[model samples]
Target: MSGMINLIKMELFRLVKSKGTYLTILFVVIFSFLLFMMSSSFGEQSKANMLEEDNALYAEITEEEEHIKSGGIGFVGVDFTRDTDIKFETIVHSFLSSGVFLIFCGIFAANTVCNKYKCGFQKNLSTYSNKKWQLTASENIAVLAFTVTEILLIVFILLIISVFYFENFRLGSAANIIKYMGMQAVLYYAFATLIMFIVEVVHSKVAGITVTCLLSMGFGSFFFNKLDEILKLNNFLVTQHTIVYNAKMLPIAFDGELWGTAATVAICSIILYNIFSAFFVSSRDMA
Candidate 1:
């Protein structure tokens, strides 16, 4: 236990000192900012158009009222107002459902794992430690920490930007946001572990990044969906049972069924990937 903890500590320190870590965070921030800005601009334009229509209708109604008072026939149209309130939960859902978050985090995880090999860190660690699985375990924990950090940072930045950009901004239910974010965090960790597993198996940075990027972008799910369409295996869709699919389809309002499905997928992925990663790490020659 002490050795595992020490290994975890070393992994965290290495992650902190790594330049790629900062670069990943920077890229996430920039991408998130740009996304929010574009959404905000589009929202503003929509609201402006709605307000203009509302004003024009109001003016026409006032004129009709005057005409009716003067004993002239005038029909006043029914007033319709659109709800343009942008909720915090909506922003979070949009961000998560886009799959961009997973892509960024997966790339970071792949880079972190592959860099260990490039820098000879994995070789040294394996040389000193008989239990090679501990290194994989430690890397998993560190990646989980980085995933959580990214989640919090993205949420914080979005919330701050929403406050400034949204006139009718609402936070919606606190409980719902918490539940949604909690599940997403689990899925993110699962994704990171899966990336680590892939990196361990491929043992190449380029392959790791390429495969993770494709997977994160939903290519894996797309292929699975197509296979399901072709096979029609008892009407069971494999894509629906995948982590990437669940993460992309997760709703802001928690439904027990969907939430359970997502939790199951994420938990299974985390366990299976970590087991495979540990086995690969232990069985492979680091020399």
Candidate 2:
């Protein structure tokens, strides 16, 4: 365990030295913040609209309570029908915010895995200990580090927008944002692992990344669109089972079989991928 952790630390240090990676993350942060700020304005307005409903559902609930002088058995919950509308507005704004941010996360994953090999770090990394097991471990560590850093950074970006754009931030809504963040994080983690191995096998960084993005968007949507049947293989896909850990965002409920199957697929693919990729690094002549 200690050996693995130490190796991971070294991997993180190497990533820190890459100017392109830093620039990419920073650029994404700026872009996400700007977009979030814009979207949050709408969210704030929606919240305000909810407050203006004094003569709306809440008021009706009050009137109902007065009339229910019958045994104190008032139908209070049914009176808040407008809560449904507020919930929908929140969902719309959240979807927009998440969509924009996830694009950057996918790109970031592509860059981290693809560029690491494209730039010749793989061969250099092997010189220290080229054993396939060790090599795979190190690569996984590197990708994990990059993944965690970018995810937390994205969360911070959203927090900034929530504060600056919202007129009055409600503590309860924070869970929603957290949920989305966790979902994206889990999905992207699988993506990074899958993309790294996939491209490594194909031996074409650009080709691998491109195919991944297409498949993720195209197939992932299909899975979501037809959850009753399509959800059967979600765990196998890695993109399917991740639920964001936020209060404001709706939680995702995944089938256990789907997650188990997808996880197995990804795990097996990762093993074979490292094996094939090992040949290129261990055998190739490095500069």
Candidate 3:
């Protein structure tokens, strides 16, 4: 336990000192904020355009009414008003809707193990007191990294909410949002660790990252959705569960079955990936 704690501490220090991690975090933050700002600006512009059209129509109607009153025989015009239909719900969840958050985080996950290799940290770990301890320490550190990443995400979300919304911005329930974020953190960490395990097994950073991207942002979700649709296997598909579980985080009635499937798949992935990573890490020659 003490060794694991020490490893966690060391890993946190290493991550904090790593420029790549900081750069990735900075990129995600900037991209996410840009997305939010652009969407808000577009929404406001749309509303303004609608109002302008309404005003123009009203002017035309009044002109026609004056002409008719003067017996100038102008055509009749109808009154019209543009109602603001901007859905706060859409704005509040724009981060998820934009797909930027997920993509950036998924890419970060793909690079986790590769970054370690590039820094020669993995090689140093091979010289640890015990080979098993090396893998164990790495696994714990991966968890710590995931935790940090998730916390950063929560912070980003809060910052966005504060900036984009000031009044009437409280999501359905504050408690629910916090709980939902906690659930998302667990899911994201499991997914990231799965990528980490893949990187360890392949021993090729490029290959590992490519596979992670495919699984997280590419054909993996597409094919999984197709399979679920054709085979009625939604409960067992990880990608499907990921989508379904994220939906449950919204301010609406939750689906128990989807939540259950998501929980089951997340737990299974966490267990299976870690076991496989440990086994491969133990057997592989570091020399």
Candidate 4:
């Protein structure tokens, strides 16, 4: 127990000191700003287009009474217009469902795991402990901790940006946002563990990074979707069972079924990856 705690502490200390950690956080901030600008610009253009269409419709209506009865000349859709009340929860959903967050998390996990092997740090750690599984457990716990921190950072940055961007921005339902973020955090932890498993098994930084990039970019989900089509798995898409797909499908508004699905998938992935990682670590010689 002490060994595991010590290992976790060491991993966190290294994470705090690593340049890549800060670099990743910086990239996330820059990306968030760019996303907000692009989304806002698009929203303005969409609002303008809607106004033009509404004006043209009004010209054809011929009667003010008829126009007023016809929904007041206002357009309704999913586009984020200035008239649309923006919520912090909605912004968070957009940012995370973009898949960029997962990509960054995967890359960070790959680097964190691979760097130890690159520097012979894993071997040195192994000499002090015979229980290889403890190392896997500790590193995974540390990475998951970092994942939660990153999620919090992302929410904070987005909240700040939304406050300035939206005319009447709202914090939305606190309980809902907490539930949504909690679900995403679990999914992200699973993703990080999967990346760590790949890095540990391949034992090659390049290969691990390549695989992580592909998976993070949704190639793995694409392949599964294709297979479901080819195999004619009706009413059961293999893609829907994947972490990437779940992350994308997770709604800002809580849905019981989706929440259950996300929880099951994340928990199963975490358990399986940890078992596989521990098995490989125990069987293989670290040096």
| Each prediction's whole-model lDDT (CA) | 0.77, 0.50, 0.53, 0.76
Model 2: lDDT to the true structure: 0.50
lDDT of 3 by residue, 1-287 (tens): 66566667777776677676777777766765555555556546645665778777556646754433222221111221123233333333333322234444455655666666566666665545364545544545655465557445645664565545644443344444455455555566666666667777776767665664454333454566677677876345444455323422332224476456656666777777778877777776654
RMSD of each: 11.4, 11.2, 12.4, 7.8
> Over the stretch 187-282, how does candidate 2's per-residue lDDT look in tens digits?
555556566666655557676656554443343444443664655663343333322111112233333654444444445554655565566555
Best prediction by TM-score: 4
Q: Lowest summed-lDDT stretch of 10 residues in model 1? A: 73-82
**Once model 2 is optimally superposed onto the true structure by TM-score, how far is the C-alpha of residue 14 displaced, in angstroms?**
1.4
Residue pairs in clash, model 1:
none
In TM-score terms, candidate 1 sits at: 0.84
lDDT of 2 at 65: 39
Error (Å) of candidate 3 at residue 258 is 2.5
What's the CA error at residue 109 for candidate 2, in Å?
A: 3.6
Enumerate clash totals for all models, in the order shown. 0, 17, 0, 0
Ranking by TM-score: 4, 1, 3, 2
The TM-score between candidate 3 and the true structure equals 0.70
Question: Which parts of model 2 are misplaced by more than 4 Å?
Answer: 1-7, 37-100, 125-130, 173-183, 219-287
User: If both were scored by TM-score, which would come out higher, candidate 3 or candidate 4?
Assistant: 4
- Cα misplacement distance, residue 7 of candidate 3 (Å): 1.7
Pairing residues by index, what is the TM-score of model 2? Answer: 0.58
